[model samples]
Structures are given as C-alpha cells and as structure tokens.
Target: MNILQLNFEAGWRGGERQTMLSMLQFREEGHTVHLLCRAGSQIGERARAAGFVVHERKGSGGVIGFLALSGKRYDILHVQTGHMLTWAVLTKLLHRTLVVYSRRVAFRLKGALTRFKYRKTDLVVAISEACANSVQALGIQHVPIIADAVLPVSPNATRSQMLAGQLGIGQRKVVATTSALAADKDPLMLVDAIAALKKRRNDFVFVHFGAGALEPEVRARVAALQLQDTFLFAGYQQNVEALFGLFDVFVMSSREEGLGSSVLDAFSARVPVASTSAGGLKELLADDRGLMSAPGDAGGLARNIGQLLDAPDWLGAMTSKAAEYFERTHRLDTMADAYLVMFEQLLNERRRPRTAAIATAPAATPGIAVESHNQA
Candidate 1:
C-alpha cells in the first residue's frame, strides 16, 4: 500500500510520536509511506532520520503544493492533526484517494467548517473512546476507536543515574510526568500537587519532561511556591521511555487528554501511574491499573500520589496490572495490524461499484450538514 501522512504540527508532541510510529510500522510491513510535515519541524527531521521519504513544507499552502504535485500517487492520505484536516478534505475532493483522519483530541466539533471537514472524511479514527464519542456527537458516524501504542524499552540504569546526577535528584524518589506545560496540561495544578505533597514528605522530587508556552508560568509558580528544590523542569527529553523506567511513579495532571500515551509509556516501563480522570484516561487507568483524581484538583492528585508512595505493595500490584495490560493491548505490531486491516477494508469497499456513490456526491460546503452516515 502507498500512503501519504499529513501532520502540520511543528512540535514533537504525542500526536507526532504516534505519526512516526505508524509511518515506521507501515514501512516495516513493506508499504511505501511518506510524511508531509512542517519544514524544520521535529517530526519531519525525525522521520527523515528514520530513512522515510519526508516532504517538508510550510502550511496549508504547502499541503496544496504537495497535492498538486504528487497527491494522486498515493492510495490513502492519513491526516494526523486538525490544522491539516481542511487540506485533507480538499485533497479528497480532487483525488480518488481515501482520506483518513486520526482524531487525537476530545474537543467537540462545533464550527460549521470543522463539521463539514470531518463529514467529508472517508474514515475518522479516534485515539480513544472519549474522542470517538466526541466525533460521533458531531454527526460523523464512521468514527472508530484505535488506541495509540507505545514502544516498550528496557530500563537504562546508566542513563537513569546520569539523569539523576544532572538533575540533582540524588537518592530522591522520582515522580515524573511527560507533557507540554500548557493550559490544557494543567502544569500549575501539578506544581500545586507537588507543593501539597511536599508538606507531607520531602523525599520525592517532581520531574517534568516537556516544554510549551506555559513553561515560564509553570517555572514562576514552582519558584513562588518554593518548590524549586522539589520540582525540576527537565524540559523536553526524547528518550521518555527510559526516564519512565527510572521513575518511582508517573503522574498526569492534564485537564483533558485523548488517551494519555505517556501513561502507556509508564505502563510499558512498568511504573505505576497517578493521573487525572480526564477524557480517555479513565479508560486506560481502569481495573486498578493506576490511581485517578478529578481534573484540576491538586488535592486529589496529591492524595492519589500519596496512596502510591505510601504503599509499596499496592504500587507493585498496580504496576504489575499495568504491565499486563500494556503487554496485552498496547503492542506496536497490534496497532499496526489494526490500522492495516482498516486500510484494506476501506480500499476493498472503495473498489465496489455500489460504494462509488461517495464519489458522485456533491462537494461538501461549509454550511452543508453532510450526513456522513450514507458512507458510514
């Protein structure tokens, strides 16, 4: 199969990581995959380094250029971000290629433009059930839930020791989280939780492994709360799985999340998770795999973390369960196989004369409430 993946994000967030994983897996399965990403972006650079054919372009205009140049060469166009959804819709109108969108956020599609773009998509793959529900509510009946996968890593004790020395977290229990310090991530709430946890115990240190617009604000709050000693904004680290293996516990304080792939990374590393019950996190942390708290509640987050810290036996049980869950459901090959199956089904359906009605339909417009159930 020939595939063209579109992602306009300039940062290396969870979505970008998943995009890379899918592209690499497809290539490994003897499929030709190409990535169209922002010029000089981390995803583009990484994809190129991984020996994939990468087209680096600027914005929606770049997307148009790519489609005009080589869009017809691919069988499928997989769009991985919202910024590129409109471009994908336009491409679908211009080509026979099936346009598949992966919805990574749980935000509702309210705008007419947003709804129209999604309605015209051939398939909408939600990264979590919460995200699928949100998409279905917007009248897109073809939404399917395909959870993201994480690559398991062996614990790198040497790297952990080096990181500990560099961060000055010697002999301290590490409570780590990997998230962009943004409003949605609620980094301030994490800081507050760390502050509250400090009041009870000072033996643990909080480490964050991401950067965002809210970095300065988070740092200022950490200082204001006198948590400079307890909190270490380790910035963005590429080998997060290695760091997860070193962590005593992984905490997620996001106000909203699609599925919390970082939590999956923690599970892959056999670390217990303490996260806010935001979006699909509730689903991932189910069955006593981890402890959860309400979103934006620092007190609850602290209490959950305390439960893990105060009980080693309970933590071991949770980590063991998480590891089992990861082994069962989060394998890279399993995710790749599921996607390939969906791709084959869509392609086979497209080959049917009866399904050609989708191509004969009127072009989607901003105001038209296209009832996608016809194609669904």
Candidate 2:
C-alpha cells in the first residue's frame, strides 16, 4: 500500500523512533511509505537514512499544509492527533481519504471541537490499551489498541563496551532511561531515586539518555540531592537502543507517556524495567513482569529501583518475560498486518473512485465503538 504518515514532532524522540521503525518496516515489506515532517528535522534525516521518502510539513497551520499534501491519491492517510484533525476532516470530505488516528498519548482530550474532529476520523490506532481508552472516552468510535513494535534488528555493540572508560559504569549494572529532558519526563526523579539507592547499595549508576530543555535543572537537582557522583546525562544518542546492553534495568520517571518506546528497546536487549504507573506503564506492565511506582513520587520510584537492584534473579526473570511479551504480541509484522486490514476495510466503503485502486476513504462500520482501550 502507498501510505502517508504525518507527524508533528521534529526531534527524534521515542514517538519518532516508533514512527521511523514502522515506516522502515513497511519499506522492508516492499510498501511505499512516505513520511511528512518538519524540514531538515532529525526525523527527516533518520527517515532518509533508512531509505524512505521524507517530505517537509510547512505553513503556519499543519492542517492546511497536510490537506494540500493529501492530494496525490494515496492509499491511506495515517495521522497523529491535535490541530491536524481539521485536515483529516477536510481530507475525508474532499478527497474521501481514510483517516487513521494514531493516539500516542493516553490523556483524555476535552472540548466539543476536539470530539467532533475524532468523529470525522475513520479509525483510531493507539500505542497501548490505556491510550485507546482515552480515544473512546472522547466518544470516538472504531478505536483499536495496537501495542508499539520495534522493527527487528541484529544486536549491536553494548554501550558499556562503547563508553566503558568515561561513564565509570562497569557496563554490567547500569540503569538507564532514554527520554528527552522535558519537564514532564522528570529526569531528576530518576537521579534522586538512584541517590536514595546509594544509601543501601553502590552496585549501579544511573543514565538519562536524551537531551532536552531541563538539563540545567536536572544537573542542579542532582547536585542538590548529592547524587553528582552517580548520575550521567548521556545526551541525545541515535544508537540509544544499543545502550540497553550497558544497563541491567530500564528506568522511567515520566509524568506522562503514551507508551514508552524506550522500554521496548530495553526489553529487546533483555533488560529489566522499573517505571511509574503513568500513562501506558500500568497497561504495559500489567502481568507483574515489571515494577510500577506511583506517579511523581520520588520515594516510591526509589523503592522500585532498589527492589530490582537487590533481586538480580527476579529482575532477570522479568526481563525475559518482557522480551517474551514483546516478541509474542508486538511484532512489527503484526502492526503492519493490522494496518493493511484497516486500509482494505476502508477502501471497501470508499464512494469516490481515485486514480489508484488502493485508495481508501474514511468510513467506519456502524456500532463498532471499541471499549477495551481502557484496559491496562
């Protein structure tokens, strides 16, 4: 299928990682996948590197820019949420394009305008069950909870062997979190959590892998908490997935997450995970395979970290389970196959004929409102 994916984020964060990997997978399967992103963005660079067509999304309003881009008789319009919904509605009205909303965030959206935009969409694809629920709560029908998948790649060198000299980490007991230094990510919480761990143990060091706006505050927080000796801000590294080998456990301190793409990286490397029950964490770790702390509670986060550090065997088991869970339920083929089915379904309801037989239009099967999106 000739698919067009529109994303608003320019930087290569977790969400961008998911999008890139998915597009690459489609290309590997011989599908024509084009990515619409900001000009000269990290996403554009990465997409081009992976051999996918990367176009710039221009204009003050993304809705206008996206609608103009939608005119080339594509098979499906895979879009992310926000003001772009206006474009999706217009595309559905004018070009009869199928709208697949990928709900990457789990927070409930307010206002009637937002609700109406969702109604105009044909299907909603969420990264996790938690996010799917948020779509349904807004009265959006035909919501499907599709867990995020990582396109399989051969294991690369571990970060420990790559940076063994500078990090002061032995390459065995490193606990890492790959998130942007945004205020909402709470990188300092992970620092403080590790600091609290030092009172009882000294076997591990913490690394926050992504760079963002809160770097100075995070450094100050580490100094204030006297955790300067242990915490490392690894900055933004494209080979972040490779770093999973350096860490024994993956740590998350997100105030909110649609679903953590980094956690999947850790799992792929067979690393255990400890996270707050924020956003999709509760749903992702529901089988008790991972530890979950209360959101925004540094003390609770600290306790969760300590649990994984002390019980190496238990943590190992959890890591294996996480890897197993991902391999079984979140394969890239499964994600792509589901999308293929949705596109085929949408094309059947298409009224206006396009130049391409593959062109699919927005049309939802009646009374098919999905409710399990709230499952976590």
Candidate 3:
C-alpha cells in the first residue's frame, strides 16, 4: 500500500505520536509510507530523521500549493489531524485517491465547513467510541472505532533512576501525569488535587509532563498554594514513555479527552492509573482496571491517589489487570492491521464498476416511490 500521512500539528502530542507510530508500523510491514507535515514542525523533522519521504510545507496554504503542484498519487491519503482536513479534502480532489480522516477528538462537529469536510471523507475512523459517537452525531453512518495504539515502552532502570534524581523525586513515590497543560486537560485542577493530596500525605511527588497555554495560570496556582516541593513540572520529553517505569501511579485530570493515550502508556508500564471520568477515559479505566474520579473533582482525585498508595496488594493486582488488558487489545500491530483492512475494503469499493454496484443495489418496494439522487 502507498500511504500519504498528513499531520500539520506544530508541536508533538498524542495525535502526532500516533501518526508516527502508524507510519513506522506501516513501513515495517513493507508498505510505502510518505509524510506531509508543516515546515519546521517536530513531526516533520522526526519523520525525516526516521528515513521516510517527508514533505514539509509552510502552512495550510502551502499544503494546498503542494497538492496542486506535486502531482503525486497514493493508495491512501490519511489526515491524522482535524485541522488538516480541509487540505486533505482538496488533495482528494486533485489526486482522486482514497481519503481517510482519523478523528482523534470527541468534539461535536459544530460548523458547516467542518461537517462538509467530514462528509467528503471516504472514511472517518475514530480513536474511541466517544469520538465515533461525536462523528455519528452528524448523521453519518458506519463510523468505525479504532482505538489508539499503546505506545511501546522500553524501561531502563538506570535511566529511570537518573531521571528521578534529576527531577528531585528521590526515594519518594512518583505520581506522574503526561498531558498538555491546557484548559481541556485541566492542569490547574491537577494542581489543586496535588495540594489536597499533600494535606493527606507527603511521601509522593506529582510530576506533570508536557507544556501548553495554561502554564502561567497553573504555575501561579501552584505557587499560591505553596506546593513547590510537592508539585514538579517536567516539560515535554521526546521519549517520555521510556521513563514510565519510575511512575508509581499515573493520574489524569482532563476535563475532556478523546482517549487518554498516556493512561494506555501507564497500563503498558504496569503503573496504577487514577484518572477522572472524562470522555473515553471511562472506557479505558472500566472494570476496576484503574481508579477513577469525576471530572474536576479535586477532592475525589486526592482520595483516589491516597487509595492507590495505601493499598499495595490491590494496586499490584489492578496494575496486572491493566497490563493484560492493554496487551490484549491495544498493541501497535493491531491498529496497523485494522487500518490496512479498512484501506483494502475502500480500495475494493473504488475498483468495483459503477454499473455493477448500481445493479446490485436493493430495489425499492413495489408500492413505494423511490427517491433518486446523483451527487458525490
């Protein structure tokens, strides 16, 4: 399969990481994969370093220009981010290739253009059922759900210890969170939860990974609460998954999430998770796989953190269950294979003759008046 992945994210995040994982898996399986990303973007540089055919464009306008001028063709053009859907739609017009859009967020389609662009997609694959329901709300049927792949973790105890010492988390339990410090992620709430948890115990330190728009507000709140020692900020690291072994518990305080990919990483590392019930997080943490709290409930989150720390036996059993669940359902190969199957099914549909497809269509009842339409 010839695949062209379009991801224009300026920074690396869950969606960008998934895109890279999918590209690497497709390449490993002997498929020809190409990447189209923004110029100077982290994903573009990373893709180029990974030895893929990288096309770096300036912006959305640059993407349109490239689609108009490059004259390249592929078996599939997959839009990995929502913002780049317009460009992908235009690319479909220029190349007439099978267009697939990966919907990774659980945001409802709110605008005319957004709905139109989704309608134009040959296939829309959602990362979770929450995201699929969001797309299906647009009245588009058959939205398939393909969960995000669990990022592979290779733990080095030496590296983990070194990182713990570097972060000043020596000998103390580590409560880690790897998410953007944005409003939707609710980092301020995490600060409050850490403060509340500090009141209960002082043996654990909360280290939050990744940075975003709400950094100043989050810092201000942390300082006001005097959690300088209890709360630590570790800015985004490229191989964050490698250090998951140091985490005693992974916590998320997201107000909304499509799927908490970090929670999956925590599962892979066999670390207990304590996350709020936000969107697809409920799905991942179901069946006592992890501790859960209501969204924005700082008190509840604090209590869950305390439980995860206090009960060692239960914690071990829960982590073991979580690891088994992740291994059974969320491997990188599973996601890549599902995508290949979808790609082949779409290609077959394209290959079927128009007249033959029409002839096979179900006939309307004899007494009913059938509506006729012609549109693409």
Put down candidate 1 lDDT per residue, 120-180, tens digits, no spaces. 8889999899999999998767787889998886778888888899999988888999899
What Cα-based lDDT does every candidate model obtain? 0.86, 0.74, 0.87
Candidate 2 per-residue lDDT, tens place, 165-254, comes to 676666347777888898778776777778777887878788778888889988998888787767877788767676566676778898
The top-ranked prediction according to lDDT is 3
Which is better, 1 or 2, measured by TM-score? Answer: 1
Order of candidates by lDDT, top first? Answer: 3, 1, 2
TM per candidate comes to 0.92, 0.87, 0.92
lDDT of 3 by residue, 1-376 (tens): 7888989998999999999999999989888899988999999998988999999888778888776565246778888987677887866667676789998889667888888988999999998888999999998998999999966678778988888889898789999899998888999899999999999899999998899999989989999999988899889887889989888889999989999899999999998999999999999999999989999999999999988988667788898899999999999999999998999888777766654756787885589664332111
